[model samples]
Target: MTVSFTETEAFKTFFYAGEIRLLYFLMILMAIDIFTGLAKALKNNKLWSRKSLFGYARKLLIFCIIVLANIIDQILGTHGGILFVTIFFYIANEGLSIIENCAEMGVLVPQEIADKLAVIKNEKGTSVTTEIKEEFTSSHSRDLEGDTAEVKIKIEKD
Candidate 1:
């Protein structure tokens, strides 16, 4: 029998009251964050495709997390409480990031934001990968335990 998606329980659950709205709101926040981030990057002349790629990857991960939350809610019969909380958490995080980006664009920024921007300017991007790469390459490669990444990259042909 050919089945239509709208005839399925999954479709009903997917369109459950308020859940789709929350999802749309989260999407809107994510888009706004990207827009503000791009504006900030342009203002600072710091545009990079790598950063944009990572940003989209992070947004995808956010959606995955929310979907996981919804799955949990279904399993536990909490009626989407966990999913709503997950969505709201991302909303707040995205909102704060938008504020920070606006601050970089020279909006009415707070002193704390100004101080943070100053620090960011002096320091390179603060991704953990960047930090670890710097740690292994810098003169200060040795950690407190005198440890450093010692392996070199090589490919062995099969």
Candidate 2:
């Protein structure tokens, strides 16, 4: 007996929203992030088996969320908006983590480059990927101020 094409897992996955290249890039970034994180942890003598398992589980959950976002996009008759946004968010998040891991490993990353990666976003009222690129480019030269905390003191003398 022969199974129909629609009855195959490949067909179902192929119909998921978003371009294949985006998914490929996400996978690459995730792998890099995991590797760097492990290296950093090992360097600090803080590597734990349970923490590694948790990291794997987190990556699995990310893929599941992307699938759900793709389904939502299909239900809304849209072309990969949810999928794109979800993937973009993860990519930026993982990229930032990878950068931090590198820093922890004693790799020097320029402040401007780190700042650019931190500001990568898919803002409302703009093209998804385009806005991310634009923001990264523009944020590089922008100064980011540190948040300030206020302290109060009261003294009474009689």
Candidate 3:
């Protein structure tokens, strides 16, 4: 029998939250962030094994969070509402970190992206990734104390 649709495939249902494309995007962002972060650390001559492991662990934690969100969706039958929310938040968080990393590495990140990242970073309050990045690359980090507009990104990684 010819297969009609794989939307309900067990593999996709178990591994993905809602849409496979969204998970793909999230995975791409995670990979980009990881590589850029490693590059930034290498350029700064400050690659620590512990921090690197923690970074990888944190990435693993993303999957754990997704699983929890997926379970919640299954229980509540919310149709991936929780999962989508969780994934979208992570995307923004990772995107902001990536932009910051690229800019700090002197990659000439456009002002529009820099400005937008600042907005998102402000929203993604007290990110561990941001803290670690700042810890290693404070020399090039910009001051955010003067921004008037406020955006609060609620990431519960602590």
Candidate 4:
């Protein structure tokens, strides 16, 4: 099915454009969350069916909510804001759950990544500045305030 984009001024600005679709933004956000979770899982060597299923379900729910929001907008007018709010809520929830899942699997999910995720959740659709990106990448191996966890990977001998 084909859908057409309409220009509507809401919140003092145009909400939708001809090129940028809401679905596209949602997909990118969901993909980032899923990949981040998967990376943490792999780092801990605990990637399994359960975690993958959870991530998939979470992504599906986010997309479903977006569709629901569009339906609501059609039914009751002025519901785009509600869609943004729902997206933000799920984003934060899924982000936190990913961290928790990593912790369960013995992955530290470093405070640095957690902090970066928090900032992203708070900003909600804003780009991360260059300095922030550098700090995030550099935070991986450096000790923060000299507090670091020693991750011990065990190899079972055959």
Candidate 5:
């Protein structure tokens, strides 16, 4: 006896009608970008219109690029593997950009993690054992006193 299971309605809903996990993550990223941009503007006491515009443009471009890639994949009759690869590359790039933008707002990201990501971007491939080594080292080790990251803020008094 053979059992055949087709894609569920729930999966189809997420892929087309609803939000996929990556899309939800991207939405969170967008919120962070907007909040950080607003915080920076307020901190500097500057009423810059470009900041919001820039953040919006980034979000729009990311979505547009992903959609375009999906369209191309459909035309070429390629499975979503190609689209997923494109999404992965863009996700990493956008993640890096988000970190940089947050850093600009005085939210410091861990140096070691950032450096590791930079290395990954540059390096070819890591051996299985090497991946474990990369995960253990962190510049913000102190922040993870127990198991969670505790962000420290140094406020200036006028």
Candidate 6:
């Protein structure tokens, strides 16, 4: 006898919650981040047993947060807004970490790009990743208040 799609564990865990794609993407990012991180650590001879375990635990916690956000969306009778935003935030973070890991392995990232990534990662808040977006928007608006013509000239020069 064939089981219905909804009867499967994968469906219940992911499709039912409308987060299968986001979860899958997050998992992929997590795996890449972990592999890059481990490679960097091994290169530097700093791969502590407890630290690696803690890093895995932290990834698990990130998954739990996405699950919690999905539940929150359900309770509010909304779609996947919360879960999507949460996953997107984590994805950006993991992507930045991967880049940093690659740089640590002597991959030669541009200094300006590395500095900007460092600023984003070092932002302190309950949602540092989210705050980076807000800060960027605000900074852009502030820039607009200064001479738009001058900015245009600067952009043209660049």
Predicted structure with the largest TM-score when compared to the true one: 3
Better of 1 and 3 by lDDT: 3
91 Cα displacement, candidate 5 (Å)? 2.3
lDDT of each: 0.72, 0.73, 0.78, 0.57, 0.60, 0.73
List residue ranges in candidate 1 displaced over 4 A: 1-8, 12-18, 109-158
Residue 138 lDDT in candidate 3: 38
Better of 2 and 3 by lDDT: 3
Clashing pairs in 3: 123-151, 123-153
Ranking by TM-score: 3, 6, 1, 2, 5, 4
Worst 10 residues of 3 by lDDT: 136-145
- Deviation from native of the Cα of residue 102 in model 1, angstroms: 0.3
Local accuracy of candidate 2 as per-residue lDDT tens digits, 90-112: 99888877876786587988989
- Per residue, candidate 5 scores C-alpha lDDT tens digits across 1-158 of 65323245543322322225666676776677567667766887874675456557767877777777766666576767656777777666557656655655677679986565456543555433235434444544555677866799999999
Selected candidate, larger lDDT, 3 vs 6: 3
Q: How much lDDT does candidate 3 score?
A: 0.78
- Tens digit per residue, CA lDDT, model 6, 32-115: 999998998899998877667767887988877877777777767677777678888998888887887887688989999777
Candidate 4 TM-score, C-alpha based: 0.45
RMSD of 4: 17.5
Model 6 bad stretches (over 4 Å): 1-16, 110-112, 118-158
- Per-candidate count of clashing residue pairs (backbone under 3 Å): 0, 0, 2, 0, 0, 0
Model 2 steric clash pairs: none
Question: What local lDDT does model 6 show for residue 150?
Answer: 33
Clashing pairs in 5: none
5 or 6, which is superior by TM-score? 6
TM-score of candidate 1 relative to the true fold: 0.64
lDDT of 1 by residue, 41-82 (tens): 898898988767867887898877876776777778887688
For model 4, what is the error of residue 3's alpha carbon versus the real structure, in angstroms, after optimal superposition? 8.1
Q: Assess the local accuracy of residue 31 in candidate 4 as a C-alpha lDDT between 0 and 100.
A: 74
